[model samples]
Target: MEKKSMKGYIYLMPALIVILLFTAYPLIRAFLMSFYEDYNMISGEYSRIGLGNYKDLFGDKDFTKALRNTSIYVVFVVPCSIALSLLIAVLLNSNIKCQGLFQTIFFLPYVTSVIAIGLVWSWIFNSNYGLLNIILSWFGIDKVQWLNKPKYALPSLIIFSVWKSMAFDILIFLAGLQTIPKDLYNASRVDSTPRWRVFWKITVPGIAPMISYAFIMGFISAFKVYNEVFSLWGGKAGPANSAITVVYYIYDKFYNSHNYGLASAAAVILFLIILVLTIVQRMMGRKK
Candidate 1:
């Protein structure tokens, strides 16, 4: 038994080493760097500044705006994505012709390159000569500057995000839908229960877990939105910084401004926020 246990431990060592090298080391280094005041580009030295870096982050206006924008994006995107996904999943789950083709078309966005999608979507949302504005012209609506205007930019990004993410949620919910026994629906029909009542009572409860999973995933992803905004707004974070997200703020600090310590502090704060929210979600899920 002792020999067998030793062999098993030896087999696990490689995986554990990889995890420590890739995950543990960077996290530990970042946590330590957050305590110092340093610029990666200008200075080679990292001087200890205690909690000063974190203190400065709170006073930074850009960081505040980024956080606010991230919160707003999360609020709008999460529920909308989940709801749209659920609806699509339900429709796709029905006995329709060319179901496989429909599933493939819906999921294509999820698998496509983010940069490519952002580029294509940017043109589609262009103020003039864009497909959307062209269609709106038929309704007597004027051109809308989707990316150039502060008010419309973030909402446009959210709309694009919802479209890109809904496919994955649809797949997840479809899996859940399949697990729900067909006998329940048949029995409800036999009992003369209305379709709406059957869905409310049966379908919703049956996919509650999937809905919860999709909500948490969507919320987390929306909070970290950067690439789309960067591509759509030419890396300026949209007009008036309306589309600046927390991750993008961190990127600007570390890469553009060379503020290593402050960037690490911002990253640490973001980590804590995500960690706490995830914990709360898990607790609520357990309670349910």
Candidate 2:
């Protein structure tokens, strides 16, 4: 037994080393750096250990805006995407024809490159000679500048995020739906229960865990929204930086401005926020 355990540890050594080097080391280093003042990346020197970085980050208008935009994005995208995905998943899980084709079509965005999708969506949202504007013309609505205007930038990002996020969510919901016993559904049909009542009483309760899972995953993903903004706006945050998120702020600070201490502080704060939210979600899920 001792020999077998030793051999098992030997096999796990490579993966453990990789995790320690890549994941654990970075997290620890970032946390430490967040407390450092006037830290030099090249020299690895700091004037002192303090909360100056955090204080400055909180005072900065750009950081505050990024936080607000990220919060709004999380609040909107998570619920909307999950609800839409659940509805579509329920419909597709039914005895619908061409289920495979529909599922494939819905999932294409997940597999496709975000850069490519963003480019396509850019054309769709174009103010002039765009598909969306052309559709709106039929309703006699004036053209709206989606990408060009600051006011509409976050909304455009939200819309794109919702569509992209649904792919994995719908897939998970479909899998969850399949796990629900068919006997319950059959019994509902035999009792001649109203479709709406059946859905509310049976289908929803059956997939409660999946819904919870989706919400947790959705919130985490939405909070770290940077790449979507990058792809959509061609590496810019948005017009006048209206759509800047927490990650974007960190990137700007660390790379563009070369403010390592401030960036680390912001990154640590983002990590803490995510950690707290995840814990709260788990507690709520347990209670439910």
Candidate 3:
């Protein structure tokens, strides 16, 4: 038995080593850096400053704006993505022709490179010659500067994000829809149940777990959104900091400002937020 256990441990050692080296080491370093003041460039001298970095972060208006923008983006994008994905999944799962083609088309965005998606969307949202404004012009509407305008910039990012994220949620919902037994729908029909009522009572409950999972995943993804915003807004926070997100703020602090201490503090705060939100979502899911 001891020999067998030793062999098992040997087999697991590589993965354990990789996790320790990559995940654990960086996390420990970041946590330690959060308490430091200035980062040494030439001599590598990092002095301890207790909670001063965190205090600076809290006092920073840009950080606060980034947090607020991120929160709003999450609030809008998460539910919209999940609900639209679920609807699309239901449509695809029904008695429709070319179901496989539809699935491929919907899932394509999820597989596409973020940079490519951003570039394509940036062209589409261009104020004068873009496809969106062209269509709006057909209806006698004026051009709108999507990336340049503070009010429209965040919403534009959210729209693109929802489009990009919908594919994954659709696949998840499709899988859940398949797991729901056909008998439930047939039985409901035999009992003279209305179609809508059958869906509300049977289909909704059957896919509740998938819905919860999609919601949590979408929420987390929306919170961590950075690449799209960066690509669209020329790597700066969007106009007037409208499209600035938590992760983007952290990246700016760490790389642009060379403020590793405050960046790590921001990361710690983000981790706590994600942890609490995920726990609350799981608890609510269990109750349902």
Candidate 4:
């Protein structure tokens, strides 16, 4: 037994070493750097150690905007994505023709590159000569500047995010739906239960756990939004920084402005926000 345990530990050593070096070290280093006032990466020097970086971050309008935008994005995206995905998954799980094909089409976005998908969405959202504008024109609606205008940037981002995020949620929901015993559905059908009521009472309760999981994971990912903004705006946050997120703010401070201390502080704040939200989500799930 001891020999077997030693061999198992030996097999895990490489992965443990990699995690320590890459994940643990950087996390600890970032936390420490967040407290170092006026930290210089090249010189490894700081004027003092306190909450100066955090104080400055809150004082900065850009950081506050980023935080607000991130909060909005998460709040909108998580629910929208989950709801849409749940509906689609329920449909796809039903006995229908071309089910496999539909599933493949829906799941394609999950595997496709975000940049590639963003570029396609950009063309669709273009103010002039765009598919969306053309469709709206038929209904007598004027052209709307989705990408160029600051007012619409966050909405546009939310739309794209909800669409992009639905793929994974749909996949998870479909898997959960499959695990549900067919007998329950058959009994519902024999009793001639209304489809909507059956869905609410039976299907929903059956997949309640998957819904909770999706919401928890969705919130965590949505809080760290950066790639969608970058891809949609071509490496920019948004017009007038309307769609700026905490991750984007951190990147700007760390790389563009070379404000390592502020960036680290922002990263730490983001980590805490996600951690607290996740804990809350789990507690809610347990109570339910």
Per-candidate total of colliding backbone pairs:
0, 0, 0, 0
Better of 1 and 4 by TM-score: 4
Name the TM-score of candidate 4. Answer: 0.95
The per-model lDDT (C-alpha) reads: 0.86, 0.92, 0.87, 0.92
lDDT of 3: 0.87
Residue-by-residue lDDT tens digits, candidate 2, 250-274:
9999999999999999999999988
Best by TM-score: 2
TM-scores for candidates 1 onward, in order: 0.93, 0.95, 0.93, 0.95
lDDT value, candidate 4, whole model: 0.92
lDDT of 4 by residue, 1-288 (tens): 344456787889999999999999999999999999989999999999999999999999999999899888899999999999999999999998999999998988889888888988888889998798999999999999999999999999999989889999999999999999999999999999999998999899899989998988998999988888888889999898888899999999999999999999999999999899889887978886
Candidate 3 residues 1-288, lDDT tens each?
A: 344456786888999999999999988978777887785645657776699888998999988988999999999998999989988998888789999999999999998898888988998999977898999999998998988899998889989999999999999999999998888878887899987897789878888889989888888878899999978877878888877889999999888988888999999889888898899887987787
Candidate closer to the true structure by lDDT (higher is better), 1 or 2:
2
Runs off by more than 4 Å, candidate 3: 1-4, 41-44, 281-288
Model 4, poorest ten-residue lDDT window?
A: 1-10
Which ranges in model 2 have alpha carbons more than 4 Å from their true place?
1-5, 284-288
* Alpha carbon lDDT at 267, candidate 3: 93
